[model samples]
Target chain A: MFFNISRYLGRFKLVGCVVRNFLILLVGLVFSVNALANPNLGLPPLNIPADNPQTAEKIALGKRLFNDKHFSADGTISCASCHQEDKAFTDGLPVAVGINGQAGTRNTPTLINAAFFETLFLDGRASSLEAQVLGPMLNPIEHGLQDQQVIVDLIRQDRSYTEAFRKAFAIKVDEINISHVTKAIASFERTLISGDSLFDRHLFGRDHTALSSSAERGLTIFKNKGNCVTCHEISWNNALFTDNRFYNIGVGFKQLTPVLDKFIAFVRQGNNPDYFPLTAVQRSELGRFNVTKNLADIGKFKTPTLRNIALTAPYMHDGSMKTLEEVIDHYDIGGDQNRFIDSKIFPLHLTTQEKQDLVAFMQALTSSKSPNHPTGE
Target chain B: MFFNISRYLGRFKLVGCVVRNFLILLVGLVFSVNALANPNLGLPPLNIPADNPQTAEKIALGKRLFNDKHFSADGTISCASCHQEDKAFTDGLPVAVGINGQAGTRNTPTLINAAFFETLFLDGRASSLEAQVLGPMLNPIEHGLQDQQVIVDLIRQDRSYTEAFRKAFAIKVDEINISHVTKAIASFERTLISGDSLFDRHLFGRDHTALSSSAERGLTIFKNKGNCVTCHEISWNNALFTDNRFYNIGVGFKQLTPVLDKFIAFVRQGNNPDYFPLTAVQRSELGRFNVTKNLADIGKFKTPTLRNIALTAPYMHDGSMKTLEEVIDHYDIGGDQNRFIDSKIFPLHLTTQEKQDLVAFMQALTSSKSPNHPTGE
Candidate 1:
């Protein structure tokens, strides 16, 4: 009897140990999963290239260079000329007018939250913001800089610029090249992120009062019936508002003519086929195809985050849509029917009340008012 | 000698009193000016319309209605379809998609900071968010609700909804109408205002390190070289980043056709113009003109604040420009030659460095990361 009792105690002890181990393992898994989903509700930090580290001095020097309009062929346009802060870093125009009154095919994108973008440009031609920084400097339709030497010379001419370069990069004035300029600008770009939206408050902050019942319902529809989550995935915790993927919902491709296709092909190569030089038409397409050169990518564009959608209007890569209602209508129709339409395109068949609820929910995503600092020191 | 001394003391006393009063007056003036320039950034306790005081019950009911996919024609989409919480209450698309795969014309604007907007929509068509909320519901391309009664019937049929309505508004479930729906949704929307960008930190919080040197330069350029301040007026203290005015920067008017002129004329009639349905072309031309009915407002649109321009891209009223660089190029040329161009449109001669600096500065305008509190509760 004593031997049996001792055996029973030992068995009990084993079971207790097993239960404790299981609890520990479960806790570990939860933590690991949380760590994996490093959700940033707004823009993520800009990814600076390994070759270039961001320094205060370089960023300052780059900023000075950016505000100067001498970079353009006509010497009448600076990067700031269009990317105005008051206009949300955009020129507030339907289409961009380039050097010498040259009109570009697309509208300017705001630099706000640009740091988080995987590929830059409407067509995603540039893989990095640094690469994107230099595109307009040389584009004949844009700043129209004569060459990299012009930028180098301009920086060399300014003593303040030279000193700034030295302070930022520890490089001699002559060594401050286009790559460094782009790098510095890119570093600054990393700082642009807007996170504090009401939606964030509602979801992550657990502020039940932050969202109204209508908005809460709208959120449910977005996640379920609307099928918006399929493309614009709302991660486990953080909601960046974008999946950062590319899709073609058929905006510009109404009737793909052979000529248009050929032009697209030429532009898809981007500036230099050997190196990739995008033509006007190809540049017009905008998004993934410009970067990948895959036929499947035709009319495909990168999915942008919807952090401040209410402020921006005339939506789409082409800016064809006029209002949010119109945009909703287009989506209801499953996008323009084109040969290369994304498989995700399907009719939502929402009701009028449901649409209103969705709009209501969207309006609830805005940020609350807070204090503001003075603009100048 | 005693008389002389007494006289001198008397004079001194009088002078002191005069100086003290003057100083007090000056202080008062300064305080008043400061108040005018920089009012409290916090919004007044969200003005739940008198007819629809927000209640936990009403909000909950609204949430249910918003999420109900049954509101859609096909029962596949709900109010949340286009506006997802994780995506800052906007579907991460250049334009919103709606029922039956109907593509929307405008990009889904983020609800963040929406409470501050004086006007709603890209064209400023809706005067208030409440009015705007109902727009998508009736649109064929969006939810396509069969009738307003459908909403009422749904709420009436559901026991939970009926109880919720009673608890929230002290109204019978039958009383839940379109007006009540919009008011509830608008109340929720009033909560969506973000005011915590790095710029905000530097400006309001006195965190000098919040912005990089590039961003500082960009601010300077934005105020000066970029000439952005002309349209995007910076409040002396708080920076909502908008002037809330309308201007035509030569958007969407290459050469005004008769149809365009007629539309412009129609818009010039101001609010409550001859009520008539517009053709699609006329609708396209009806930007700010639709709101004000002034010829000068032709092709003009309400100025959007530059709070989160980075996140909501494919910039401008028409999402025409793709990059900030392209936008700058447009301003460099003062837009395409047009009749309605704002006097503000003038070539800005900036250098490459300046442009880069401007881009850097604009990038700084983005908000920083923070905990999202969706529920204010």
Candidate 2:
């Protein structure tokens, strides 16, 4: 009887061990599933507007609108026209030509990773991408649309669009308005995020080989000798490459004659026709002043991200400097000192080798591959 | 004697089992280390150019040059002046303003992620980024440099620059030429890559939350309803968002009168002195045809990538379209019908909901975070 009892006890111990091991394995699997399903992916979630919480249907609708070219008067250009896919969503030009072939007074900024930007436009006029979306539709130089009714008419004409609207929102087709357009476009724009640069790999993933030694050294110079970090600022998490601030780097310092003064004054009051009579030439010269009434904002422009600087050329707010060397020269001199120049403008006194090092580092910022979306079709 | 022998045998067996367990542990450690060091982590290795292999010293030198603005004629512009890091290395403007405040015809392109481009410039004039570096330096409308010797002189005058050259190239300071400048700038450009987009996570990494359902639907529309992927092919591996081709979408149709045609023909045949006489207006009208004498290539502009379309607004080659909606409207009509319009130009009868869906998809392309680079003090 004692021998039988001993055998049974041993068997019971063996079964207990097996059960514990199985339970541990199950727990591990559950934990892994939870980890895989983590929605944030270790990234900070975006602060979407209250009215436009990110939804699958809304994003889909916005994307369709983004690629559809039916919003213009002539139906010949789409959002993708100026903002193409390969050129970081920029048209790759010195200036943007609009609906009637009318040229505007600014370069197209890259939208590759623009969702992080605090303000929009070269002059920091629009506070958000959604707010800025409506500015161009109303501009005579762009799509040349007369009013909101034209967009509504175009939408009402299509059944598929009506169905898509029904699926995205409960509102009827006739109820669709400018706010809806902006919301959808904003939703789409918020999704364009670019990360995983060589620098990011080096810093975040601890991949030393991601950046060459020279590039690493250049990064040091960019932070130190080049003094680029003063304004550009590398964050611990993300690097949008802009301070989200405005400054005048002395691009508009041609002697302000009577005509120029009047133009400047008019632009300072904003682009509103009620406050000022702006000529075509004057309108072109209206930089930051057009957005803000402050004189200090004259020639002051919004800081852009440096994510894909090598591809976009004819540098500057006016697209004047052609080569990177010329651009470096301008900054080396602190932007042709003028009365309106920002106080931050000061001689960098960067050595030629240091300049080259900075350039090398910037090149390292370029990616070896482009991002492509999977086509369900 | 029998008992002693049995005890010795049992001890020997115990020692043997201990040794076996130790060996197994050692093997497991080696395997774990190897797994941790695995180089291929889902993504392919970066492609470095054979002509421009990455090196520590070279990148350092390039960074130095990138920050040095003395390379310009007036010593007022640096590569950083227009391509400020804070501004994503772009001066906020519809058109670039160059030396002596001369305004350029197009908007400044961002240098971010530019190394992947097969050809440089909006018109695809320069075949390589390296070749493009010098075009702007010598262009009368840009940096306005007299010749390459000026750059060499500027370098020779700086002691720090000379020392850096010796360390980077093992050559004398005087040996620095335009080629060296271009190479450095190009090397730096190569580093300006943008990876880690939300779409990348959604597709490649199998992160389901990377894209909203609306964005996913918009992606479908971008491929099917919008027919955008026809020209803007999204790669399987990298989503560059561009096919890198040229097309004429009727940008300067009104400007292309019979007189304009004769003048363009004169310029292309190198006989403009008698017919067009190089007037400012005539010179400005010579778009892509001036670069490639192919008549079929007239008015053809390079297709841009749409990675970050929302941030860089005032769309098109002329900065005319103020909003994405206007851009969509223009494309709905397949561009103004003209003599040299692209065959792909056709009216896309999209619904209002579809337009909104498209815009939402575009917003989804925006990055939630920005890049982090060292800022200048």
Candidate 3:
């Protein structure tokens, strides 16, 4: 699933720096099940909204629609474009490329355990999966759709979709609204939940042999001096590797420092934050501030799950780093001096061996049971 | 599956008539298998090229590559764009649209029983599926790639493609060539043979009740007064429903008649047939003339497979006929007067009942076994 992140960079001239926001999150599993080697433990029951309960028809229909590109303006670019099944559902680019190669600011975050996240997206602009699924389709530079009707119209064009819509939503194809479409896609995304990692086995299954010596040492460092378990929380009984909280760990925050003063002043003036004419990059760097007008939340981003950390490379909200080693190195130096940096991030003077061990431990967090596992494990 | 063919026209400002060629041929089945309901008759032994034999690994790799958009220049369209499985490999559009909404000049023919076809594409420009798979990737208006290396470079960028390529071809990632990619795709395509239609059951299994009364009457009309059996050859045994030949049915040729002399003179002066300056529409009308330099080949196109005629509509080269009724009516009028029209296409003077029966018979050509079957039977 490894793709050349650099190839995408120099292939086209910078298109005004529309960064893909790759905000990933993890919640310690919902259940305290005993099959820990099966990270399947601690997985909280999926939150199915009351209106849209899970059904086989909706999930199956959603899978088809997710892979279909006709819904896009140019009949190209589907949801699977940036969110590939392999690579833990993240396209391995520094930033995501959209319809007509519209580049965005941020990495594609893994949706492996997205079912547990409180909010959706790096900016937290969307609150639920149903709401989140349709946002990109309408974004001018994302799917480049003229209107939401583009999807509805496209869905109604094919009899298969018509039948599928009827079976899933109990509505005629033309009668299907954006809500039905998003609900179906959300159902499919819910099924992408991954569990049963090697680390989970070592911790919960009481399997002494599950973790390699290097990975075991990495796990210790992750919990102790590494300080990774705090935000990427590892509870006594479960390890989702994220506290599901927002933190500005100093990547894009430094870039926004210069723009911060004016942006905050604009927000104070009681104007809609989205009305600002910032470049996609600048808007993306706003992080949680866009969601909440609080000045203290300026550079905060959702703490992403590290469950499949090894597979999702070019890490962070901006996908600035290309490997786990680069990520560890960034954090090793406490990230580069940003004013709004989270207190959780600090310089850890780890040796080269310790870095390798930590990376190994993160690698061990990848689910072996998931079909779309990066290695196809 | 049903698509509103008329909706594409008159809905948008007519886009300069880049009609997709719809050259259909029916190959009578090569097999005489007794299990008419088995859905396996009429399928000829898959013609795996000696150079590119079928293997499980190759088929799997090809399937992935077939669905992958990365191979396209813009990372958008793939082979599946116009050849969706559900539409019997046709996109249900009158003409095929490619990347950037660039439309082509021929109806998407079904690949359901393509393994048994003698040549690939309406113009017969490609001799085999191996040759056909790569044609779209490089066509400026198709996949819109600048070079074949774009696909190769794209394939090597992903670890899954690299691993799959190695396992399928016994070649390392960097060592991969374009031939390996095409071979794999062709192998997968060879497996798209569909059979066991109600027609097959009625014909081969001696099941009189397999077809509706209307369909049975339509089958008689097809063989008798309709005169469809000549071009769409129906053998006593297998029902591939094609003679694997070329014909000019006077659809686009009537439009090209004025330009015919100039085109012929251009070819007479030793111009490359394929390099002729024509819009996608003009080039498509040239048809088999592009393959063979013979003057008689002007407007001639290969006879396409009719295994899933019902699923792939907006029938004929240029997709002029939206329904099977339109096709029957066209032959009823002996097509528009073109000097180059195939002698096989003659006016049938069919009654209203006969026309309805013919349409019903064509509908019965659909197979119930394919996963993507329109009926999902």
Among the numbered candidates, top lDDT falls to 3
Kindly list the per-residue Cα lDDT of model 1 for residues A154-262, writing each as its tens digit. 8889898788878888899768887778888777766555555666767766667767788788787675456565456454345556656677777777534444556
Scoring the B chain of model 1 against the true B chain gives a TM-score of 0.75
Relative to the true structure, candidate 3 reaches a TM of 0.45
lDDT: worst 10-residue window of model 1 chain A: A368-377
Q: Candidate 2 residues B302-347, lDDT tens each?
A: 7776655665565666666777788777877668777666545556
Give the per-residue lDDT digits (tens) of candidate 3, residues A1-377: 11244345435446312221111111123223335434365354467789989999999998998898877777778899888877778898999888888788877878888888888898677878898988888877678889887788777888888899999989976688888899999999988887778887777666789889999999777755565764686644456676666777788776777777787788879888788668778877878887886666777888899887777887899998888998899888878866566545667788999999998898888887666565565
- The whole-model lDDT of each prediction reads 0.65, 0.65, 0.77
Report the C-alpha lDDT of model 2 over A18-120, residue by residue, as the tens digit.
6556666877999766543332221333677778877788788888887877777667667777777676677767777678678877778877666777888
DockQ of 3: 0.00
For model 3, what is the alpha-carbon lDDT of residue B25? 15
Task: For each candidate, give its TM-score against the true structure.
Answer: 0.42, 0.43, 0.45
DockQ of each candidate's interface versus the true one? Answer: 0.01, 0.01, 0.00
| True lDDT of residue B353, candidate 1 | 82
lDDT of 3 by residue, B1-377 (tens): 11244345435554412221111111123233325346675454555789988899999988888888877767789899888988888889888888888888888788888888888888877889998988888888788988988888888888988999988988998799899989999999988878878787787667798889999998876754565754575543466677677778778776676677787788879987676667667877878877877676778887776777877888888888888777778878878867676545556668898899888888788887777566666
